[model samples]
Target chain A: MSGNSNATASGAIERLWKPLVARSRSKRALLLMAPLVIFELLIFVAPFLILLRISVSEAGERGTAYAEGTWSADAYANVLTSEVPREVIVHSFTIGLIATAIAVAVGLLYAYAIWRADGFTKSLLLFSVVLPLLTTLVVKTYAFRPLLSPTGTLNSLLESVGLLSTPLEIVPGLAGAIVGQVYIVLPYAVLAIYSVLATMDWQLVEAARDLGASRPRSVLEVVVPQAMPGIIVATVISFAWSVGSYAAPFLLGDDVTFAMRVEGQILRDFQWPTATALSVVMIAAMLVVISALVAVLSRFGGEVEYA
Target chain B: MRRESLETALFRAGYLVVFAFMLLPLAVVVVTSFGASGQIAFPPAEFSLTWYESFFDQTDWLRAFDNSLLVGLGTAVVATILGVTAAFGQEIDDGLVGRLLAPLVLLPMLIPPVIFGVTLLVYFTEFDLQGSYVSLILAHTLWATPLVYFVMRSVFRRFDWQQLDAAHDLGAGPVRSFVHVVLPNVKHGIFVGALLAFIVSLQEFVMALFLSNHTTETIPVVAWNQLRNSLSPMVSVVSTFLILISLGAILLAAAATNLNWLSKQLS
Candidate 1:
């Protein structure tokens, strides 16, 4: 087979080959990438540009709106002055920060467990970390509805355990939002931090232990410091995701984030201007967070390459 | 050493509780789905498959499920193609071109899906393409592509490039060599990429919320609507099915790449 093919190869200067050889090899990558690049620019970038334009445009009593004379900042002004939109922005940030804290705390344990355990335990730990992602966020949060609702699983369990005399109102508020966001962001935290630790040299930690430091001390001094950059990255990932998230707060009945606000403005009020403005604000906030992400990636590319 | 061991034991116990918290919601949901009792109670007095049956009985749930499956499959195929192409492009040109393209390709993942949802909602309304499956699938493809590209890129990076050279030297054309030589080696990446793409599409909610309407609603969208209206046992039944599919996907991913090897793929 090789001999026949080799003969064909050696004598392959055919009528169909001249231009192909001249132009094909060098332009192969460019051709391969053309479709994806075009799709992104059209479907992703163009829409965002449109969103920006739409924010300045008006939304009338009838339907979608366009600018009348020049671009207007009325939508922005309304959002700033309005009670709901302004509070949504601040509340989302607060939830994001809280969610980031919870994610880091739980995620650190999961990462540590994965890093320490060897065989089956490691996979189990890994499984727990990733299992939340397996189901939709809505489904998980929906399940939480029962547990956080009156006479639900959590209340029943707590009551049966003699811990509570009255049912706790854990759902449909900021606390529920935090719990839901934590559930969503925890995996990301584990993944981000674990990705860094996976590439890290373990010899240093062992050396610290050998030099008479306790395990906790050694970890605090050696492991935590080395993994700090990753922790920061993980924190930012969780925070950004939470801030930009719609599902968690929406499901928890705390649908007051800028993301959810955009949806609400569109669906409820049919007000494209206010929604677009809120979207722009959300994108701006995300951009700020993303810049932080970019900064970390640039400074610590080697640490998070696999992530 | 004794004190440190005690600390380690305490941590183990703490993590046990944390993991329990992790599993609690899912367990409660699953358990309740099989219960005979009404009103979303815990530790049921009896067990039944009433909810699962009711889920099948409803046409709305079935239609939404069908739409979800259709869109998920479409997104998976589209994302995998784009991902494979981008991965190939990166492999072929690992210079400034690759570096420049990386962030742009990764833009969908970096930015929030809600942002894309909002942008597309407005854009679609403008272009008169609103509420179409094509529009929704395209939006989801944007979300799923980056993951596939990353997975495939890693798989390609770890392969031996010499095998391809050998195939070429043996007189195979580029396409033939890639099919006969490279494809076999990278099948795992393809498998993982496809499954990851599928899962992303299956579980996607935000984009579908903005893009889909009555006819084209995905499962997550339907579930969200149902949850907003009332807590039905059918939601659990549907969620349970999704969880089962996710399990299948994970097992498939594990089979595609060696579990231990893939576990440390992040490293």
Candidate 2:
């Protein structure tokens, strides 16, 4: 294994150093790729490089940053030591984990339902999932207000119906953030899980049932295992999505998430070091998530080929 | 006639409940937009088009709406060119270019928009491009092209390249063959991608908040500002308008293209 890796490493270096191979690239292909590549380099790659530099940068006044100084790890140190950053990071994870769990639960059922249904029923079900996304997230999240607010329509209705004695403060807190994030992320989870479930062999579940497995047992043993890849993908997607959430928490409450803190530090306090530090942390989290996603997807890709 | 078992019946009913849960908020917004009571409330005492009228009367809202339209149009055009080019480019050399470029081009999708927004704001400020339509469109284009790429990749995957080969063999040049043969076949993908890109830019506000100036303020940013200040019924009016127009855009594109490409690509 070591010898094979050594050969590949040296081969990679040779490929990197070779200009003759680069010259062999088709002119037409290069021309076609020119616009997108240049656009991405300018707009995507450059900005991200700037972001990395800014993260390591010494905290400057609001407008001018990294104007004169060498790179510094002071920002990372500040982020690690800050109470707000620590609490907010933990808070974001807890919210993301809880929301992803809820989304997975509902999304699995919805995806399974879509898989089982035929014809227009399937379309309607899928459309319903996608419909929420069609509207602006603010619209959907704001709509939660009338339902969850103290003395809002829901509480009024509940009071009249004798179901409750007082209003609930659910819409402007952690609960509200979870609801909004789950609402936003649920459709993705459904689609992710559905992609796998749609191709599953239902006959296996039927066989299990025929061989004395109960319905729940058959699903638990057969269906879940078959859909495990998708479930895992959906969970990771939703978790990443929830962790990166800013808008939902922005509408629900203030300074409620790590994302909000990043925004706040930049726009509110003009604390570049702390904001960039927090962003670096978030970016690290994103990289970890992306690597996990890529690793699982590659493994899943291998499974398909082997099958 | 055969009937579904209790389990199947319950499952279908469960889907209905979930649908209700998902769509009920939108229903409330639509209904509340026409609230005649002048206060935002569900199941209002009466209904009116007053808020809709107010939405039209306000210059700030109209300018924001127009900015969204103008920026959406710019973003759609720029993103389509780049996206279609990249998508078609990926087909060349049997995927060499795409394999090398995928990580860079697709990174924007994975980056948190807030982080991206901050990054753009910081960069644009240094470059003196802050609060300009060029910057806004570029930021939007960065966010939107990947969607177009995905839609067109699936379209290209299902496409047959022999038609283009035939066109090339007939003495038509590369551009001509693309415009004549490949273009006709992939127009549905182009249409779907452009419309989705337009919608994505129109709905995106995070970057807009960072990148847009007073003159270039998009509708979502305007709406976010409005919502942050207070939960006004006028917000509902604007949202209801957006919802209607989006639905109209989808249906128009679907009908005009004579293909359900939008729904198909989305599914």
Candidate 3:
């Protein structure tokens, strides 16, 4: 009877200690996460807040300190009403749309090919796609300058072949910018779409074939629908990236896009208030695009099932 | 049978064309790097290593390379340490604090880097941290930590806690159990994350452009300035070197980790 009583007492102590141990474990976890949390707060969150505050203030005159008092909507008002600002926004969106569309269309086809190809072809294709992504953006941009220059490869080849009467100017323009942007972003689209393609069950294709569906019909009806979520994600991410991209446009676009305009205002002109306001607009636009993408995906994409 | 044959032929042709489209420009760059004329041209009249030699001769280029190496290595070490610890903490707690903090950690990657750069520029100037190597390292660390966190978080999720508990029950201390049991399990993830951080810091342009002074300009920033101020075939040499470095690192990392498995997981 005394031994039984001792056993019950030990069991009661064990039950009490278990919760304490779990709590301590969680406490240790929180301790681990603190550094990242603090770093983000100090660097990311704080600066963004500062930019937000600056965006509300009015721009000072050239070489004058920006007035720090009386927060107003003047900077935003200027961005909305100004021709340069409006055109920049439109140009940014247009470039983003065209680049994303091309990227997705090409990426979808590429991913499809990769999925059906032999092992060697699959590896080669995958490597080629990711190689550009691994390179520095500055390097890629500089490389594009030579390729797209009037006296560069494409024009030189055309002229040599007697196809062009004159050198075609390609670089330092919107065309060059779009081409460079597309090259940089295409890998992202391919990675996104290929992931979905790889996950799809080949049995579905076989089943459709048995049901008398053509290969193209099977892909359209079954494959495309299944891959829609990934496609949407790819489009959204590519668009967002294009919209905010500075390096390609700055190097290749020759001050043609909104991103370039923003950079110019901040870096060259030192118009902090104007740049801050433009930044806010860019973020708002991105948020809108993302929200719309989420809504559309939720409605039509269903749940993405990966194999 | 005819239809099947035709479909296969079409698919093969399409694949070849797509592959060319994807690789043609980069191939052009590599070929042009060997140009004898030391000018940007598509098909070279002659082949020589003159541009490559010129690249090596420039002192600024060498200094810029050194800067890139230092910044990249620094960011990798610091970010990986912080990211690993944070990932560990989040995994252990799985509490409200972890959930709330998770998105904040990821915000640097998700938000447009322009905003991040500008914000850092303002913040550093405010704190009088501008033009310092420490500031640049800190910025790059913030930029890289998210990638490390993502990698380590997944690693921790797959880790078996029971193993650690077993080690502890067998009379191992907490630190010993971590070093012997947990470290080995997560080593691949940590290595890959560190490699990625290194690569990112090496290639990063926008933030470095704003943050770095003349004395501390990284390879990318120096390249950007060179591109803007003067058109030089020497730029191609630098670009090619950067490409080679990144490719070497990626291949090395792939050899270290099961990249195929990791890519599958990311997908």
Candidate 4:
């Protein structure tokens, strides 16, 4: 059966390209992809190159943003040595780890629930997730101010329920920042896991159960291994977005994140080189982290077992 | 069996809590939008449209809303075109160009928008195009096109190319086949892609914050400024309105395609 499946897959691949291989070499294929490639080069690639250049350029004179056509490693050196940038980077990574962990864990459970559900319940569960994906990020992040502030709804509810003697300031604090960050990334995380879960065969878990595997044991062995791809995607997304988060930290918390520092450099201090350098360094770090994550996760994703 | 039932009940109760966490903020904003008092109070003391009236009365807010609409529509059209063509080209050819273009297009979505915004700010400043609608639309298009591409790639993957083969076996030419046959089947996917792009541009704030000026400021940017400066109910009204637009777009896209298709693209 496995050999037959492999033959079918190979045949399908051959069929997919038999007609297109000839046309791919024609000018039409180049024409088809040219506009988008050129647009990306001009808009996306060129700007990053410029950002790289600015990162190495010397700080500008009193009136300027950056000194054009001058080379200096001062900005990079400053970023490495300066207390503020170092603190901001650490803070950003901390938030990223925390938010990514929570988002992935909760997202897994939520996706499992949705997958286990049927009919109207399943659709409703899925729709609720996508609804937040479409809503404005800033608006939703800002709403946390009213919902979690010291005198906000959560505190009031807790107090009324006799859970608290006084309202504590959750907003403009670390807790608010994490909650808001998790909220921003949760929908994507759920969707990612659910997408994988939707395609999974439930009988694998049932078979595990029949083999005397406990419920949690069955899920850990059968479900999580299969869902590894989605988990990786969700982790990278939540981590990267949280690390470079702007709206949540800016609106709900007083913590100075890497993004907020970049904003200050550009808008307030006019330190273009520093801001660009900081961004360049963080982007490099993010690439390293994400690559490592994908590498490690794919190892777990290897060799899916058939029931 | 009793143990299984109890476990299922506990799992459901936990799931409902997660669902509430997701919807809490948006529900708060909607509820507060109708608060009659000057302060933002939850479970409003009284219901009224005073803030909604204020939002409409303010010319600056209205102008920002118009700017957001303009940018969103522009992004939708440009992103859909680029995304469809690129996905089509990549799908047909499994070559070096397709491999290269696949990751290159998706790079924008993965990178931090703050970095992208600052880079565009510097890039546009060099060209004296900073704070212009063209700059805002271009920045948004770069961000949004990747989403459309992601969606359409999956759409094209599941596409029945046998139909294209049938058209080719007939007397129809390549272009004619693509126009008459290839496009019709994928039109729903195209519509959903465009709608997704529109929503992305409408909600995007980081890039617009850097690229837009007072005259060209988008609704999210304006809302950010207002949120920073004041806790006005008018912001709530604007948010409520934006939420409605996003919800409506999602419903429309859902109607055009289906939830299953959307979920597949998401992963």
- The candidate that achieves the highest TM-score relative to the unseen native structure: 4
Off by over 4 Å in 1: A1-25, A65-70, A253-255, A289-307, B260-267
Residues A1-307, candidate 3: write the lDDT tens digits. Answer: 9999999999996896566446554667766777787788887888888899988987776684356765878889999898989888888888888888888888888888877765676777777766676777887776777777887777878998999989876787888888888887887788778888888888887887898888877776677778887788678768888887878888778556776776678778888888889889988987897788668665646543333
User: Which candidate model has the greater DockQ, 1 or 4?
Assistant: 4
lDDT of 4 by residue, B1-267 (tens): 898899888888999999998888899899999999888877777999988877777999999989999999999999999989988887877566678897898788788889888999999998999999899989999978888888888888888998999999997999999999888888999999999899999999999999999999999999999888878888889999998998898778878988756755755
Per-candidate clashes, comma-separated: 0, 0, 0, 0
Q: lDDT score, residue A211, model 1?
A: 81
Off by over 4 Å in 4: A1-24, A304-307
Docking class of 3: medium
Kindly state the number of residue pairs that clash in model 2. 0
TM-score of each: 0.90, 0.89, 0.90, 0.94
Higher-DockQ candidate of 1 and 2: 2
lDDT of 2 by residue, B1-267 (tens): 123377777777877888888888888889989898756788777988888887778999999998999999999999999988887877764445567666667667767788888989988987999999989999999978987877888888878988888888889998898888888888978988898889888888888988999999999899889888888789888988888877776666656553223443443
Q: Mind giving the per-residue lDDT tens digits that candidate 3 earns over B179-266?
A: 9999999998899889888988998888898889998999989988988887666777787788888778767776877544444333
**Model 1, span A237-286: residue lDDT tens:** 78778888788888775557877777777777778778888877766876
Better of 1 and 3 by DockQ: 3
Among residues 3 or more apart in sequence or in different chains, the pairs in candidate 2 whose N, CA or C atoms overlap within 3 Å are: none
Off by over 4 Å in 3: A1-25, A61-65, A159-169, A303-307, B262-267
RMSD of 1: 7.6
DockQ of 4: 0.57
Which ten contiguous residues of candidate 2 chain B have the minimum total lDDT? B258-267
**C-alpha RMSD over true interface residues, each candidate:** 3.1, 2.4, 2.7, 2.0
